[model samples]
Target: MAMTQTQRYGVFAALALVMAATRIHLSLFHHDIWDASWGIFFLAGFWLRGSARWAFPLLMAEAVLIDYIVITNMGISFWSHYCVSAGYWFLIPAYGSLWMGGSWLAKRQRGLTLSTLGMAVAVLLVSEAACYVISNGSFYWLSSHVPTPKSFTAWFANLGDWYLPFLQTTALYAGLGAVLHVLTVQMARTSEHHGQMQN
Candidate 1:
């Protein structure tokens, strides 16, 4: 079912709110919930598939703004924050990987069948892996934060240490998103069926 303009707007707002609410790790509202920034981007991609020209940039801006506010709130300049570095810019492509993954899944999603679920999981794995490589690998190799004398062995170890945690967090949110997607699709189908019966 095609979404109305209002529905799209509503989804956009909800995603933005989720990002704001969870992105700030130190915020009182956060309660230490794992950051959903990565998953949010994927969800946005799935839901807002063709809106990348604008939606992606808007969400990206919001992420950066939230980071700025959080870092500056801690009495440090945003630029001086440990996470801010040359490698930070790589997030565009990293998040884009998730968005593309979501868009890819959206295009192929047929129903709540096992095949669909399998495809979703497969897409998530590949996309998240790509995202991790770009985000983590860049940070390890290019960011000034990492100690000097980087090696493939060291980076591989670093990847092993953090990859699962990142993937788990993303999967958790993606799972919720998937459930929501299924519910919406089911509801729409029911509504249409009812309409046809009435005719």
Candidate 2:
């Protein structure tokens, strides 16, 4: 089913809101909810691929703004926050990797099929790994947060510690997104079939 321009805009807005809410909730309110920014970026790429020129930048700005607000609320400058460092700028490419993955999957997706699912999983794994490496690697090697004399073995070990949790969280959200996508496409097809029958 083809989407109208208005519908595309609606999906874009919804993705942005979800991203903001989840990030803010995790950082400020719940403190337990995993931030959905990563998943949202992927979803945004899938659903709003053509709008990336503007939408991606807009989402990135929203993320930075949320961090600024959260850090300031804690009486700390955004720049001084432990999580914000020289390596922090690497997030653009990290998140971009997820977006590219989604966009790639979107182009190859052929509805509810095993091949589609497999491709999605494969892409997600590769993209998530790339994201983890870019974000985590930069933090470990470039950021002042880490002590000098970093060893590859230690860094590899550190990667193992957090990689699974991040991947699991991203997969969980992406799985939910897959379910929704299937339902939406199925419903649209059914509606189209019924309309054709009526005509």
Candidate 3:
């Protein structure tokens, strides 16, 4: 029941590695403008359970790995990509902490009626704010270098076009994340119940 420090470290390390691998694979093959990938889920997981000291370093390493691959293979600028990628990690603590807190509140309330909604909203706002700031800022910087539509309004409009799609995708991911969390909690409860029955 009680995890040793080494066990915890190993678990965290394995999770981080799997997260990095999945993100890299998705970036290489299945990534699209509208598709949210495992990276988001990984951050959500870390936020839900991981310590900031552990999660931040893992996130930074993952970001650096992905940036190197993207720059080498896709010809994207590493600096710009790093800027945006770094933002995801920056936002993870706030977003994740809120979600974790919301879940705790829901537990105290003994239902998912009002508490769930509050938590969901909190998660959404944190996610959206992070996405908006990072994506928009990255796009703005990249736009200056590339041939984008000429005008702040047009630039934002284009950004909006991409933003809405990804937001939708993130919402879907959030829903999935919530379901996974619930399932995990249920399984733990069931296991505890079984252990009690045996005793």
Candidate 4:
């Protein structure tokens, strides 16, 4: 469907809010639901377009806020949940890579062509790998009192166990969002056509 510019913006913004709330809820109360944080940021980059800059920053802030609330309420220290350090700030770039990948995909996603799908999958894989490495490496090297063996080898060995879950969750959410978007567009187009016919 040819969505009006305002309608498009509304849809994207609504999706972003929903994604943010879902991520926070899952992180706080239901860790078993799988995290959608990565996918949400990626979609913001792709769908928010001109607003991508502010959207990402806000999303990151929301994450920290929610984490703080969860930790305090649980009577736990945020630092105790994971080894944190100045290196933790690297999450900005880590998540940025995912956002950039999605933005790149958006440029090529005029349709659900095979080439586009292939490219999307490739971008998701690369983006997720980059995020995992940046985030994990930061903790392994910069964080104090890490439980992992003090070797790049040890970090690399356990990479898959940590990275795979993120990869799966991201792909699941992004793909689902894309499909729903397509359906929404189709429905809107159909409604417009029917209205015109009746006129």
- The best candidate in terms of TM-score: 2
Instruction: State the lDDT of candidate 3 residue by residue for 1-199, as single tens digits.
Output: 2345775566456545655666666667765433333335433343335454565456556655775786668877665654454333444443344334433433343333566557565656565656555556554545445465557777666677776665666666556655665676678779999999999
Which whole-number lDDT from 0 to 100 does residue 32 have in model 1? 66
**Ordering by TM-score:** 2, 1, 4, 3
lDDT of 2 by residue, 7-121 (tens): 9889888888988888999988876788988888888788877778988899999999999998899899888888889899999999999999998888879878999899999
Q: What TM-score, computed on C-alpha atoms, does each candidate reach? A: 0.94, 0.96, 0.64, 0.85
Once fitted onto the true fold, the runs of candidate 3 whose alpha carbons sit more than 4 angstroms away are: 1-18, 30-50, 74-114, 146-151
User: Candidate 2 overall Cα lDDT vs. reference?
Assistant: 0.89
| Alpha carbon lDDT at 198, candidate 4 | 100
| TM-score pick, better of 1 and 4 | 1
Model 1 reaches what TM-score against the true structure? 0.94
Q: Rate the local accuracy (lDDT) of all candidates.
A: 0.90, 0.89, 0.54, 0.76
| Cα lDDT of model 1 by residue, 1-199, tens digit | 4778789889999999988888876353555698888899999999998889988999999998898888888899888778888898999999999999999998998877899899999999999999999999988888888998999999999999999989999999999988898899999899999999999
> lDDT score of model 1?
0.90
Q: After superposition, how far is residue 196 of candidate 4 from its true place, in Å?
A: 4.7
- Highest lDDT model number: 1
> Which runs of model 4 end up more than 4 angstroms from their true locations?
1-9, 195-199
Local error of candidate 4 at residue 86 (angstroms): 2.3
Candidate 2 wrongly placed segments (more than 4 Å): none
Candidate 4 lDDT over residue span 85-182, tens digit each: 77768888998988888888787685756887788888888988888899888877888767745887787876866877778888898898788867
